[model samples]
Target: MPDSGLEGLLRELSPQVLGALVRRYGHFDLAEDATQEALLAAAAQWPGEGLPDNPRAWLITVASRRLTDLLRAEQARRRREDTVVQWTLPEEHLAPAADRLAADSDDTLILLFLCCHPSLSPASQIALTLRAVGGLTTAEIARAFLVPESTMTRRISRAKTGIKTSGVPFGMPPEADRAARLDAVLHVLYLIFNEGYASTSGPDLVRSELSAEAIRLARIVHRLLPDDSEVTGLLALMLLTDARRPARTAPDGTPVPMSEQDRSRWNSEYIAEGVALLSEALPHGPTGQFQIQAAIAALHDEAPRAEETDWPQIEALYELLLRLSDNPVVSLNHAVAVGMARGAREGLAALEKLDDRISGDHRFHAARAHLLEMAGEGAEAVESYVEAARRATGLPHQRYLHGRAARLRES
Candidate 1:
């Protein structure tokens, strides 16, 4: 197999391998490290040797051996230091042979639940989920977040340590807590996708790798929980939103607002998939925020052109979303939809209601600026645009806001 194909195969299997090791061995940090080593070995050897008949089992076997070695080494170190380790390794005789590990037993979802443990911060949760479940290298995750590789390494290390200290078992959370835990998992994925789609603080408008990883992870969750309306909705939302990526930027990387983008460039496949998923999700139960958001995205995706966007429906969906979560960002977006569906003044009125909550946010200023422009208040619009530019952290966002101000000044 080619290196790329081999690489993808290894990434897909690495988490399963790690999940199996951790589930049996009860050492997450070591098991994760061992899984990475196993992946490295596969990368080195798989190109020379043909793919294994059971590639997942092959990785699990390799990783389990590596984990055992690591565990014994740690035990020896504790012995030398005259300090007893708190946990004892399970009897080797009782453990199942790696090659004979049950093919039907997958702990990947459990692994994801562990990575999103409540003890970890949101940033750490995102980093750890990408590492453990998404099978990304630490350096690759670092580059995606635009952090130094060393910093990312530390974040992941700390996240692992946090999980260990929390003493969370290597299984699903209690049935009582499972729903909340799943929400955390979904939230982490949502954050990852949002960062990729619209980087909070970066030179680039979109980090395709991060977004793609988020989508990949979302698909995994959706597959695992096919009946989960929110899971399906989240996946649908990502697909619908990412469908615009092809037309999101210009040759020079300047972001083209959706209204100005050429609709023909959007990914129809993503749109169709997203629409289908949303259709399947909406009627299942009471609508959640993700489903509502997906419904709004489907409206945008189904539109033939920007001019045909169902803004009234989108505004209604946003309103539904706001009732579910008191998110100022949602309110800001709601203001935009109001402006589009009703009028600039009405949108401005809606935005004003969020002043107390998100007045300082660059998004608020940016939206206000746009509405001001639409209201024929170019001077105020230019001021708001300049403020937004000043407050914006991402270079692309800054450039866009400044350019808006400059255009209005010239006009």
Candidate 2:
């Protein structure tokens, strides 16, 4: 196999291999380390060795042996320090026999639940999920988040320690806690997607790798829980939103507003799939945030021209979303929708009500600037745009806001 193909195969199997070792031997941290070692071994040898017939089983066997070696080393270290080790060696099998039953059982989803254990913080959960289940190295994760490798390493370590101390099992949470656990899992995935779609602070507007990985993970969850409306909704939302990514930035890498983007560049297949998924999921639910957001995205996508967008329907959906959650960002979005659906003056009035909510945020200023320009208040719009640019952390956001202000000034 080629290098890229081999790498993809190894990443897909990393979590399964780690999960198998942890499930049988009961050492998550050690098993994780061993899994990384096993992956490294595979990457080094798989190309020249010309691919094993049973790659998953090969990984599990290698990881299991590495785990045993790690356990023995830890035991010896603890013995030298006159302290007892918490983990025991599996003396019977150096590496468990590569049986069909062991190889076939997938623990990736279980590993996700474990990585998102309730004892850990949200940051740790995201870090650990990307590290363990997503098969990303610590340095790669750190770079994606724009943090030092050491910082990410500590975060992952702390997360694993938290999981160990909590003594969570190697299976799904109990029936009573499953809902909450699933919610955590979904929320982590959402955060990851959002970060990838719009990085908090970076030169680039979109982190394609992070967004793509989030979508991949969401698809896995959707496949596992096909009947869950929220899962389907989340996947649809990601697909619909990401479909526009090709036109999200200019050739110069400047951020492009959705209204001004060339619709010809949008991914039609993704749009169709997303619409189908939303249609399939809505009837299964009383409605959720992801479904509403996906509905809004569908409206934008279905319109052949920007002016044809159903702003009123989008405004209505935003209203419904507000009823579900009182997020200030959602309020700002609702105000923008109102501006588009109604007149700019009416939108300004709606935005005025949010002064006590998100007035200090850059998004609030950006929306105000846009509405002000629509209302023919060029002077005020310029100031708002400059303010928004000043408050914005991401380079792309700052550039766009400044460009908007400069254009209004020239006009």
Candidate 3:
């Protein structure tokens, strides 16, 4: 429990500590290196000394000292006289009098924005933010991206280098540039929520810590820019989806399809909250892809049972979503809903149209298998399920598909 508490403390303070370091060092790479040194010091010192009452303050103090030492060593190696003068400014300006780092709300948001600088690619931005802000391990991020751990480590290292070299400002962008950065911010939040809601590769089905952090960040963004409908939509969408998390997996940790999930387990409070937020967001009249997705989740939450789900309404939402963003995944999901609402044949036709688009997706095969089974094509369904199982990455999901295929064989 003490170790867990220490881990949590490090997670919560990492962004603030890193931000202060970056502000002082004027380089993301230096800040990250210094933060790591601070964490190492904490690991060595905390257990024997007992956890500090003010862990963040202790971390900040330790990190500041480490940075000073690093600067002094660099100055000595370079034999530069200006190093002393340069060190004085940061030493004088960086430390707080009370040993506590005062993190104003704006400062935190600025940290988030800085992590999403336009200089980096979208993948790099997500990786860097997960590392520096979300406090995720490189291994976890590697799993999320379906890449090798070494690849992810290199990606993060390069991202920090790019930020340092690009001369991106540490503060928030101007109002003129805010709109451009909004997409990057939204993408980061989306990745954060997805990682939480369905961790790519982990023993646990849900990572509530990541989800909670994403929500906190979203709420901060909403407060900072109240009239932004997309931000409101994202918050509403996350709330609606997270509301179903209680029923998303069985107690034994197996995946539960939405249709078979016990609706009684759903959190009415979160659903109601999400619905109200979506309603308020609608009047803003600036509907985006997220708003449409939230509406679909809202419709499902409002239903009493799987059969009660408004498939027609969901189909409409999907159509709108496709128009807003032509993602093959959205089309695949829409095909399933259409099959449920209409007949399997109609759904099969829609699914067929998406064959080329979703050829690489395992869910595409899984959905097609279900539609085929419903249409009395058992052999085809079995083949599709076998393909799905072959492509599926997660153990539980692969097992589910294999089981489905075996059942067809038995029949």
Candidate topping TM-score: 1
After TM-score superposition, the amount by which residue 135's alpha carbon in candidate 1 deviates from its true location, in angstroms, is 1.6
Q: After superposition, which runs of candidate 3 have C-alpha atoms over 4 Å from their true positions?
A: 1-13, 33-65, 80-105, 137-152, 199-209, 250-253
Q: Write the per-residue lDDT of candidate 1 for residues 1-411, one digit (tens) a residue.
A: 877778778777777788888877778888888888888888888788877888888788788778878878898888889885644654564656544544543577888999999999999999999988998888999999999999999999999999989988887789899899999999999999999999998789999998999999999888889999999999999999999999998877778899999999999999999999999998997789899998898898888888999999999889889899988889899999999999999999988888577899898999999999999999999999999999999998888889999999999
Query: How much lDDT does candidate 2 score?
Result: 0.89
Per-residue lDDT of model 2, residues 283-359, tens digit only:
99678888999999999999999999999999999999999999999999999999999999999999999856699
User: Of the pair 2 and 3, which is ahead by lDDT?
Assistant: 2
| Whole-model Cα lDDT of every candidate shown, in order | 0.88, 0.89, 0.80
Give the TM-scores of the predictions, in the order they appear: 0.96, 0.95, 0.82
Question: Given candidate 1, what's the lDDT at residue 121?
Answer: 100
Ordered from best to worst lDDT, the candidate numbers read 2, 1, 3
Candidate 1, lDDT over the whole model: 0.88
Residue 385 C-alpha lDDT in model 2:
99
